[model samples]
Target: MNEPQAIAGVPLRWVGPLRIGGNVATAEVEVPLATYETPLWPSVGRGAKISMLVERGIVATLVDERMTRSVLVTAGDAQTAYLAALEVDARLDELREVVRACGRFTELIGFRHEVTGNLLFLRFEFSTGDASGHNMATLAADALLTRILETIPGISYGSISGNYCTDKKATAINGILGRGKNVVTEILVPREVVRDVLHTSARAIAELNVRKNLIGTLLAGGIRSANAHYANMLLGFYLATGQDAANIIEGSQGVTVAEDRDGDLYFSCTLPNLIVGTVGNGKGLDFVEENLRRLGCREAREPGENARRLAVVAAATVLCGELSLLAAQTNPGELMRAHVQLERKNATTKLGG
Candidate 1:
């Protein structure tokens, strides 16, 4: 056999043992993040620290889970494409049967389509248990496409990926229809906790979210997203957890919502594309397996329970880091100063200074 493959050693840390209450998982869990941005460990740590002081901690709700792939087919004309779409729509049960034969874990959930001239883009969505579902979705779509080409009249094959599935790209459709784990996490911080821990008032953070994340992103022409550094936390977490790190592209396209509830703070992060899983491509490595086990993502469970739990905790982690960053930005120079100090300290300590 050949020599063992060498893996890139990104700095990894377990930031939160943040308490999460949801249907998927109800317990305290530490989140692992592997990133070069050293400041994230402490930043998310602060948010996780704040979580424990509150009664409910963080509430993470699992909204939905799906993986999608689109197939491009050609017809004689737009009218032919439209008619072909109806035929395929009417054959949903038959298509599902074809998907069932392809893989046991893959279930054809539903699909949406677009007809452009003689081109038809059929986006097939699937439920792939415990997997990020990239390969599985493609597999199911392949089978479905074959069946379609053989059965549907006047429809010829074009491409498997029609860009409608919107994989790893920033798209409005993913936000509107959703891909991967759709999760929303919320935490209510008391006035004292907000002031003492976050070093900013409830009102300040809320206003900053609207002015910076919302209005700012809009002015910058963002596509269906508004948040500061979601990619930071997501990339870190993805790396540590052995996820398809590129998923962070569409995964980070999420929104942050903050509201001032009188003197208290209500902060939330809605991550509709938090594409993560306890199984599949990256889960086999030794370090990744250990991390998943610690996060309670490796437990014996039902069909999709493990993946669901992973997604819930992932969303909660996003809220922690997002809340902390927004809180820091509410004050001048806090963000930059922390980064400078933490990076310098880490570098010095590493060099044995």
Candidate 2:
């Protein structure tokens, strides 16, 4: 409802204390959503134009009334940090599968990592160039930590445990194990139907792909998800489970777009930076638990339910984004403006009421 107040630079929120390789540090930071919009960009092909249409559309619809807090995770050694990265990577894989299954897609590039032992605290980052994979990354991180505790012997099964921990939608928790300081992951989508105009109408293009039966055909044959979808889905999942949402922007990266000689579309997504945990600040809400239930992770149980659910959600998001983009690529401005106007009308109705 209210415009976000702008500062010269994005401010970082203090998530909590993290231990990295024998050194304990506090993690603090938040990435600003890039709002740069330019009109002079060229379109995907000749006789077209691209702008901030897609970015605007998705952000407008998905990020309503939600905000993410900062996070910090500490690990005892580099091995722990590396393990954390592996955990994030595992989650990203789940997301990618979902995206591809939703349509025909692949991961052209992907990455995962973590930062530990900073006086400034744990630094977390993630991004998904495809649709949105916040949930995938977050849930993965939580599951990984919890799994470690379960598998490891005499490892305190508590705060540092990545168990099913969801605070309010606005809080964060620090999962500490063997002094793990910070953890992060990132992924991106490289394959898009309309590359040039992705920034403008990404969601539209994905939707179009489905509407035009482009994705349906791909799905019928068989579909695979991309790393980018996984990255974004993980981030979104985390945000929903009381993790920071904005961190997802950097945690996910490396998106690629592919098309055959006939212009048949294929895409790939990847994310290597995911820093999230499930044992610190925001695991104390009733509604948050209900939301997790919707995702199928009622508690930290055997088989890592939270992590698995995150993977499925990532796949769903990728499918949705792919379909959305396909439809937009075919219809262009028509679909793009439809939702924009709908949003405006809703605002007007609310104002008038």
Best by lDDT: 1
Alpha-carbon TM-score of each model against the true structure = 0.98, 0.34
Model 2: ten consecutive residues of lowest lDDT: 58-67
Q: Give the lowest summed-lDDT range of ten residues in model 1.
A: 1-10
Model 1, 131-235: lDDT tens digits are 989999999999999999999999999998999998999999999999999999999999999999999999999899999999999999999999998898889
Candidate 2 segments exceeding 4 Å error: 1-238, 260-265, 274-280, 303-305, 326-330
Clashing pairs in 1: none
lDDT of 2 at 103: 27
lDDT of 2 at 280: 32
Q: On a 0 to 100 scale, what is the lDDT of residue 61 in model 1?
A: 90
Best by the TM-score measure: 1
In order of listing, the candidates' clash counts read: 0, 123
lDDT of 2 by residue, 1-353 (tens): 66448523321121111111111111111111111111101111111111122221111011111111123344565566556555645555554444344223122123323344421122222232222333533543344444444543322322332221212211122221101112221112233424543433444444443433445434554222122233333443454455455544443332323333233233322222233433233434444455445444454554322433333333223323333344344564844575466556656876995
Please report the TM-score between candidate 1 and the true structure. Answer: 0.98
